[model samples]
Target: MGTVNTVYWIFTIGLAILLLTAIIVLLFLWKNQGQLREENRKLRMSYDEIEKKYTGVHAEQLRYKLNPHLFRNALNAIQSHAYQSYYALDKLSGVLDYILYDTDGRLVTVKEEIEFARNFIEINRLKTSPLFDIRIKNKINEADPRCHQAVIAPLSFINPIENAFKHADLQSDNAFISVSFSFENDSWFVLQVANKTNDLPPSLNTRGGLGNDIYLDRLSSVYGVEGYSCKESINNGIFITELRIKIS
Candidate 1:
């Protein structure tokens, strides 16, 4: 009877030891899982930060490439036109000064943009009315003014506007550059510019230079291709560029 009691006691002790070991192993696994989850969360956050930085860098690069060219072109035009019989050079200098000094990635009010466009037209008028005729026509729905709200990317018009002045001839009174604005969908806006070019160099369509490729790259970088639309087509000896942007 004493031997049997001892054996039973030993078996009970061993069973308890095994049960404790199992509990300890389970606890270790749970702790490891928690640690893994925390590490994953931290990694995701790091990746997101890196992605944002990269996007900013890319946007800067795009702006950098275009800005220098814009400044140089504006200055050159001023210098070349200074001796000409027109007050446009003085006006151009003022417009360029305002455009270049403005901070990048800043949004200007719609009313401000309208003023810019008007100043732009006056400056062009000095060069010769035919090369670029800029007209701003608006049909505001006062019932819901927000729909006709005006907004534009900083220095956005410099490229296309300059192109109209430089590459296209405004020698003909009929050759007028027109920029019109309209609001739709109660939250979106459209800007359409029709430039009448008497003779567009075939090189304008070529890939490498200041052609569609360069324009497309700049546009994509600024607004993301999904945010804007640009289409170019020649009709009746005029090159028209139409851009539609979402205001919201």
Candidate 2:
């Protein structure tokens, strides 16, 4: 009887030890799995951050790629009109040089931008007839030291001017486009573009056409939420765009 009792006790002790070891193993595996999951989550977050940065860089690269095509088209136009009007060709050449070289920079002086706008206007005038009335009122003198100090994003005013020309009715008797630039309180710079619209192309009438959306995106990237304001209105066959930037 004593021997049988000893054997039974040994068997029971061994079984208990086995069960304890199994439980410890299971706990260790659970802890290791949790750690692995946490590491995986961190890796995913890091990948997302890297993807976002790459996307932004890729988008900026695409935007700059457009510059070469624009330059080519402008040069072709200049070449076509070279012999017809020396004044127009000269203005177009200056504008092209600014766009190709000077405007490779992200920012430009207010004086430079104004000169670019004037050149663009003169080039457009050469394309239109006497029936079209284009008026430009620039209050900021380029010679003023203050004007030279003011700066803006390159090609900031050209988009609206292009849109105006794209939609204006040059054949109508009342066809007109007005462009004006002025300063308010010596702190805010304002650009206004208005045109009589009679026959707008279907493409430009769409929601995202004629590079308007791109212009707005560029503006938002350059100036945050409060730095600039843009207002557009369409009424009675007229289209108007106003841009206000706080330069100070």
User: Among these predicted structures, which one has the highest TM-score?
Assistant: 2
lDDT of 1: 0.60
lDDT of 1 at 155: 49
Q: Give the TM-score of candidate 2.
A: 0.65
lDDT of 1 by residue, 158-199 (tens): 455556666565677777777666677765666666677776
RMSD over all Cα atoms, model 2 = 20.7
Worst 10-residue lDDT window for candidate 1 reads 57-66
Relative to the unseen true structure, what is the C-alpha lDDT of residue 18 in candidate 2, on a scale of 0 to 100? 99
Models, CA RMSD each: 17.2, 20.7
> 1-248, model 2: which lDDT tens digit per residue?
99999999999999999999999999999999999999989966855653443243333422222334444555565566666567876887888788678877445667888888888887776556655799999987766665776666678787778767666777888889999998888878899998887765333346237466777777777665687888888777788889987773
C-alpha positional error of residue 56 in candidate 2 after TM-score superposition, expressed in Å? 13
**CA deviation > 4 Å runs, candidate 1:** 1-90, 129-134, 138-152, 199-204
Each candidate: what lDDT?
A: 0.60, 0.73
In model 2, what are the clashing residue pairs, if there are any? none
